[model samples]
Target: MLDKLRREFTLITFGLSGVVLLIALVMTFVSNVTMQNNVTLSLLNRGLEVGHALNPQMGSKDREGTVGADSMLTVSVDVTPSGIVLNKSESPVGLDEDALDEIVAKAVSGSETSGTNWARHLAWAKKSTVYGLRIAICDTYSRDVSLIRQGISGVIIFLMSLCALYAVSRALANRSIKPVSEAWDAQRRFISDASHELKTPLAVILANVQILQRSKDMSAEDMRWVGRTADEAEHMKGLVEDLLTLARADEAKAGSVGAAGPMVELDLSEIVDECALEFDAVAFERGCTISCETEPEVMVTGDKQQLERVMNTLVDNATKYAAKDSEVKLSARRDGKKAHVTVNNKGAVIDAEDLAHLFDRFYRTDKARSREETGGFGLGLAIAKSIVDAHGGKIWATSDAASGTTFHVTL
Candidate 1:
């Protein structure tokens, strides 16, 4: 349970951190791109303001002075409405007539006042001036290179940050769960200690009740009261035993009790068949029947007694809840390295929500039903689950109206 808590904490923290970091990185990249485009467009507009007659080489003193180094790569052209280029600016970069014409045609026909020609690594702006139409185009090679470097660096940093966050989150999760872990351990120990302490007194009570029942002087009404005491004592004893079993199971899971029991290769098929036979009379008394379909020599390595208990618990649970005149099916089969056991019964369908907690200790779907009627404190399935878990197997149940309810065990 502590392990599960730690895992969930780490995942949730790391996932949220990763998302925030990703969003920050994306926003930074987009902001940089937008800023770069705005600067390029501003340079284009400035280039158009300074006509070709005012050459920077001539050191023309104008309102905007000589164009900056970035604007030096700009190409400005004045074109008539009839697609005639009347004036053009000199550019350091070579541009053939065909390429220049293409750039001019695209800029003049563009829907937007300003846009970029990505294939040519060019940013352009168009405007209607006193001299027909003015088109300004600027090279964006430097901007593209800067953005590319930024993107690669951002990705590398994002990945590194995630790795570091994962390590830190795991550390935090462990530290955060320490108190809960201590409390859980304390509870388990208390249950183990309390149950151990109660066993002797319960045994003595039952023994005394048996002795009193044999007394010859007891009246009929007094005997009835003694019998009731014995019955209640027995029920209390059963509950204590169940709690003790759960405590031991918890210890086994934590490796504090070493191995729960001896594990040996045993025939699961035989266990299933035997369990079905043992529950035959109980099922018959309930107007239900036990049916077994076990494959021969289905072998698995586990504690034989614990495995038998699992089978008995499943079969007994099925028989108790099975509809009148219905069959409780117990089956075992070998599938490669795994042995499969299933107990199915035709009964009222268990709700999806209740199915999830069926193996939880003292969890009963029929809350209003008397424990006397079920002859259980709802610990049977929990014990079965603990045993299966100790054996490194899986146990779960599925229910539906058409197929009724089925408990599946995979070992």
Candidate 2:
């Protein structure tokens, strides 16, 4: 039972129930204390009123009214050698004789009758009726005590009932969220299995296509179809690879974030320069100029290969889409404890709405142009994002009518 209640939903319910129970207990205690104090004060005032009526100047022995004739049932009369005393009965049992004597003596001596319990200090003076007043301390005190005990017991019962209700609510909430959890697990497993399943067949096809392309006697028409088929196969292969990479990145982040066990120190500036040099030929083929403005020594702790992939994707995107002969700048530097890498290009402005969705898998700005112009499945930035995320980095794109588009990566 304890273990079951330790689950997230149950624990939340238990916490809420505890809070409600605490509020109830506080209110009950405060209200009971206030009521008891008020009743004690009212009894004291009544005793003082009776003393006043009996003797306006309380020190003298004088009786102004008969006790029973005063029309107050609780009032009592006492005749003594010193005075005709009027006092209220402390209870139906009347006053304690010794306590009455002390009270009478105090009243004659010109002192107020004051004591701890309400019934103990009975007020009296010599009046026409010899009437005095007091309230029963035991009855008032016992009733207040009983009420407080009953209130506590009621609170306990209410808390127990709330706890049971909370248990039921928690179970219902868990059942409602269970489907989302199951679907999430199923989706993760499907991606993991599908990526593994597709790789071997893709490798075999690529191998066979390469062998066929080398044949000396193949017709031009046949070569064209073969090339198209091989390209499509490779695109599919890259998609599967990207999916696997995203899956792995998710697993790594979930399990090992902040542990930094697999991280290594590497010079980001050197890696960016190396990739720029390698992509120079491709840039030249596309009639584009690739330039690097690198800070000499920017060190970062991450997976070197993944960081290399991030640089490669940004360069490839620039090469594919940037206008002919337009400058594509790759820059890297150290900013505080973080390394910043930026790829800027003078190209057609990317749409603001499309920019947000650009890093989503298989998403593209212009899907028709993407399909026809670049032979891209639109997973490059998505893969780059996954890789950067695995290294605890952020990547975003900004564009305007004036400056074209720039993708900034901060690690």
lDDT comparing candidate 1 with the true structure: 0.88
The top-ranked prediction according to lDDT is 1
lDDT of 2 by residue, 1-411 (tens): 122433766767767877777787778777877876566555444434444244223233335333331123123334343544543333343446676566555544544444443455332333223333232221244545677687878777877878687878678667766776667557767896899999999999999999999998999999999999998998888789878877666556546333223578899999999999999999999889999999998998887777888899999998877898899999999889898999988888988899889999878898667565776777788878877776778999999878888999999
Q: Clashing residue pairs in candidate 1, if any?
A: none
State residue 269's C-alpha deviation in candidate 1, in Å: 2.4
Taking all chains together, the TM-score of candidate 2 against the true structure is 0.57
TM-score of each: 0.86, 0.57
- Once superposed on the true structure, which residue ranges of model 2 sit more than 4 Å away at CA? 1-177, 214-218, 254-262
Highest-scoring model, TM-score: 1
Global CA lDDT computed for model 2: 0.70
